[model samples]
Target: MLRADNLTKKYGDFTALNGLDLSVNEGDIFCLLGANGAGKSTTINLFLNFIEPTDGQASINAMDVTLHDRETKQLLSYIPENLMLYPHLTGLENLDFFCGLGGKSHTQDQLESLLRESGLQADFIHRRVSSYSKGMRQKVGIALACAREASVLLLDEPTSGLDPKASNEFSELLLTMKKRGVATLMATHDLFRAKDTGTHIGIMKEGVLVEQFASEEVSFRDLEKLYLQHMHN
Candidate 1:
């Protein structure tokens, strides 16, 4: 449901991404691993149409994102490092409002159920978002995806600051989404999460994809060694 064909992005003479070719089919979780300035976020932004690509194409469900911005956006959900919701609004209210923007309407009970399924505690659902923790806010993002019945999920550093337990919870939610045939494209620095949660993995260095493989093809220790090898070189 997601594809990038020789995707390239540049700022002045510096290329932020170079010849990135990738595909994430329905029911697939593709994790991108890279250090800072490795073009992971640039790839996400291009798919989001947040910035126009300097060359090549980024598409969703075979439709070029740049050409079908509105329609493509309707088919996908994005969760950045920090999800921004109205601090004054309760979690349920935030979910409802975002779902409404996507043309999805649900009863209050249904909305509450969505949050519950996303792993938000029932008591906290009605509480103001300002009182919630980072993990709680991210569960709302998951709920938003479920409510919209989104076909694609684009996540940038979604687990960056979460504690191990919270990050594990988020990964479990993603696994549930995968069972529902949601294609996920996530850019993260967490190797263990990427290996444990992803079906496919790619490593990027200096804006180029240096290695790509199936998660089950290697041990976590080997993956770490390989990643470290690249970083050190």
Candidate 2:
């Protein structure tokens, strides 16, 4: 559902992403592990069409993102490190508003149901988003995906500031979407979350994808050792 083909992005003398070739199929949660400036967010932005690729392409469901920006965007949802919502709006209102932007409409009951399924607490649905923790805001993003029936999810550092429990909750929500055949490409620094939540893990360094493997192939300790080795090189 997501693909990057020799995707390269450069700014003058600097190459932010270097010939990245990747694919995330239906029901696959592909987590990207890398240090800062390793091109993780660059990959996500290329897919989102937030920035144009210098060479090659990023596509969703066979539609080239730059060539068919609107159509490809309709097939995916993006959750950045810090999700932004109107502080005065309730979670339900924010969900409804964003859904409307995507040309999706849901009744109140359906909207509430979606939020609940995304793991939002029932009592907080009507409360102002200003009071929500980072995890709660992310749940709304998931709800938006459900409402839109998005086939792909692009997440960048999505679990960064959350407590372990909240991060785990977010991972559970991703698993739920995975079961429904949504493809996910996440950029994260957390090795444990990547191992526990990802079906596949990739390590990138200096704009190159240096390692890729099935998550079950390595234990947590080995993954850490491998990641550190790459970082130190």
On residues 1-233, what C-alpha lDDT tens digit does candidate 2 reach at each position?
Answer: 89999999999999999999999999999999999999999999999999999999999999999999999999999999999999999999999999999998899999999999888999999999999999999999989989999999999999999998889999999999999999999999999999999999999998999999999999999999999999999
Model 1 quality (TM-score): 0.99
On the 0 to 100 scale, the lDDT of residue 4 in model 2 is 91
TM-score of each: 0.99, 0.98
- Give, for candidate 2, the lowest lDDT window spanning 10 residues: 164-173
Largest lDDT belongs to which candidate?
1
lDDT of 1 by residue, 1-233 (tens): 99999999999999999999999999999999999999999999999999999999999999999999999999999999988899999999999999999999999999999999989999999999999999999999999999999999999999999999999999999999999999999999999999999999999999999999989998999999999999999
lDDT of predicted model 2? 0.95
Badly placed stretches (over 4 Å) of model 1 are: none
**Over 4 Å off, model 2:** none
Clash pairs (backbone) in predicted model 2: none
